[model samples]
Target: MINLTGKVAVVTGASRGIGKTIAKKLHQAGADVVLVARNRELLEKNAADLGAAMVVSMDVSSADEVQAGFKEIIREKGNIDILVNNAGITRDNLLLRLKEEDIQQVLDVNLKSMFFTSKSVLKPMMKQRHGRIINITSVIGLMGNSGQSNYAASKAGIIGFTKSLAREIGSRNITVNAIAPGFIETEMTAELPETVQKEMAESIALGRFGSTEDVANAVLFLASDLAGYITGEVMNVTGGMYM
Candidate 1:
């Protein structure tokens, strides 16, 4: 078992689904978990249930709110040992029909939030000579999807961001990585049409949609002591969809 005692983690989008599970698992592994999301009620519910390390209500896309959120955490905990950039949304539209706002919103939440939150925690992380920054990317970013140009671009941008930041922080003993999860069974995946779901399943070498636990386990591994030497890598949790 990888030890995580005394570590502090900040998980964005922790109100539900994969992000929630990741937070729960990290807490189970002995890390103090800080939950971040815009849903105050749901965030508080999960935090209370897990006895969360901290809870902050803020939209990841807003720089001011993100900065203040981190300030609050810093005041209490003084450091963030792990950062999970998981808050994302899908505004699906083909380029021909996609509105400019749809593109911008998706980019801001999925890609720009990574920049906002990662930078917010960098100083604390660097001062300690340690950190784990994990970006939740997608297989669509690896293999483009129809009617999801905006989503694809955002996730791809995260891959680029992860690599560049890994290079910048590896010297500080910090590792930056990405986890690209394919076709996970969540409310989000349930929204896909039946035909599309069948097509997605058939395309995966594992012949199944993933569970929240599947992705959460990967995040735990990356955050644990076992992943200390792994950096600048995209850990595809996609069940061989892109490979």
Candidate 2:
């Protein structure tokens, strides 16, 4: 019901999964949506499907690439009203067995990318004095998962980063928040063993894994004016998996 007409929104990792759904949802709400992802072909296809809003192809883990990519977006779009830090990767393994590269790669893509992308948008958001920053964290970050130490650490780091940034920029009317999704059915989860998926579904109060649309709806709400008064908060789209 919230109208975002004339607003500009950016979603990273928008080529697939929750990111892609969020982009479409925002576009449906009348925001000019820009899709950011490393896959140019997918990004182009999504952009075309979304009416050619815009597409920025770059690895968000690199600070320089994020900086340069945002610069280009701002140059063309003039301002950014909403930013969804949804680009993330999961490198899962037990602590003792996890490789050093696994830890670093997970942190870089999941946590550091948020740092880079959020910082990149601050200037434009502050200048405009109105913005929404929605970070896609995870339920694993809140509690913990047995085999995903690195991913859990990165997502937890995002919660801290979201809170700190919200406090720092709240005065400017820019709200920063994080959304922690529980067991969402995506390509990644589809690869999990059937038994594991059933176990995950049984753990959720909703009795099923969430769909990408569920998470996208939450993002749409946070990105809308309805959530203007909400900041420095973590909204769990977890179907009561954790309270």
Candidate 3:
């Protein structure tokens, strides 16, 4: 079993879906978790349910909010051993019909948030000389979809960002990696048309859409000491969809 006892972890988008599961799994592995999301009520409820060490309600896409939120977390916890960049959104539209605002919103929330959150945690992580930064990207980023150009671009950006940051901080013993999940069943995926959902499932070699636990488990491994030597890598939790 992977042990993260005494480690402090911060999981953005922790109120629901894969992020929520990741937070719970890290907590189960003995890390003190801090839940970060824009929903205060949901975050508080999850924190109480999971016995999380802290809860920070903020818009992660906003650099000011991310910086301030991390500052507060460090002030109270003294350090952050793990950072999960899981806050993202998809504004799906065909290139011809995609709105300027939709593209910008997707980029800001999906890609820029990672930049902000990763920057906020670097100081504390570097000071400790050890850290794990796991970014939740998507297989869509690797193999683009027809109507998800904006989302694909953002996720692809995450892969580049992860590798670049990993190279920059590997000397500090800070491992940065990205988790690319494909067709994971979550609130977001549930909204897809039945035909689309079935088509997605058929594409996966595993013969089914993945579960939130699948992605969460991958996040757990990347966050643990087991992945200490692994950096500048993308771990696919996609059931062989892209490979």
Scored by lDDT, model 3 comes in at: 0.93
> Could you tell me the TM-score of candidate 2?
0.98
Task: Assess each prediction's global lDDT (C-alpha) against the native.
Answer: 0.93, 0.93, 0.93
- Model 2, span 80-120: residue lDDT tens: 99999999988777899999999999999999999899989
lDDT tens digits, residue span 120-216, model 1: 9999999999999999999999988999999999999999999999999899999999999999998888888999999889999988889999999
Instruction: Summing lDDT over every window of 10 consecutive residues in candidate 1, give the lowest-scoring window.
Output: 47-56
Clashing pairs in 1: none
Q: State every prediction's TM-score relative to the real structure.
A: 0.98, 0.98, 0.99
RMSD of 3: 0.7
lDDT of 3 by residue, 51-151 (tens): 64599999988999999999999999999999999988988889999999999999999999998999989999999999999999999999999999999
The Cα error of candidate 3 at residue 43, in Å, is 0.4
In angstroms, the error of model 2 at 210 is 0.5
How many Å off is the CA of 111 in candidate 3? 0.5
